[model samples]
Target: EPEVTQTPSHQVTQMGQEVILRCVPISNHLYFYWYRQILGQKVEFLVSFYNNEISEKSEIFDDQFSVERPDGSNFTLKIRSTKLEDSAMYFCASRDTGRGNTIYFGEGSWLTVV
Candidate 1:
């Protein structure tokens, strides 16, 4: 079975720096989503994309963030400016189909902003 993969496993950066978290979503999946879980908080949705455009996005996806399907196998999330509050585990997930398919998470890219 195919699975999502994220790079760097852990990242450390100072506030205001640019950071790009990378992921390779499951092949043949139609919907892709980005979510984050702060150290002690629940997982929160950031954005969801399909058909090459955003299908849904949460308030957490602000001006500092952007996402792209850079290639057939890679999806990326870029944070133009990082903040302390932005430190969290970012996850990439894909749905095999719209109904009944549960979105699964990658191990995650743990961002540490200080």
Candidate 2:
């Protein structure tokens, strides 16, 4: 199975600051996504991107959050202004275009806001 990888496995940030989480999705996968798990909570979907455009987004992905496929290989999520509540484990995921394909998740980037 292909894999998704993320960088800065852990991060500490001041409240009201900016953060950028980087990811490298499987080369063959066409769809990429961002999800977050607040400690002890269920994984929540943030956004999905395909063909260089956003295909879907959840309410939690507000104006402060953004996703980008900067190049053929790198996918990124940016939090323009981090808040205390923003601290969570951010996961990058990807899947092939095939129907019913399994989505692969990265190890995740743990964000802690101070």
The parts of candidate 2 lying over 4 Å away from their true place are none
| lDDT (C-alpha, whole model) for all candidates | 0.92, 0.96
C-alpha positional error of residue 54 in candidate 2 after TM-score superposition, expressed in Å = 0.5
What lDDT tens digits, residue by residue, belong to model 1 across residues 30-65?
899999999999999999988888899999999899
Error of 1 at 91 (Å): 0.7
Tens-place lDDT digits, model 2, residues 54-91? 99999999999999988899999999999999999999
Model 2: residue 48 alpha-carbon error in angstroms:
0.6
Give the residue spans of candidate 1 off by over 4 A. Answer: none
Candidate number achieving the greatest TM-score relative to the actual structure = 2
Cα-based RMSD of the predictions, in order? 0.9, 0.8
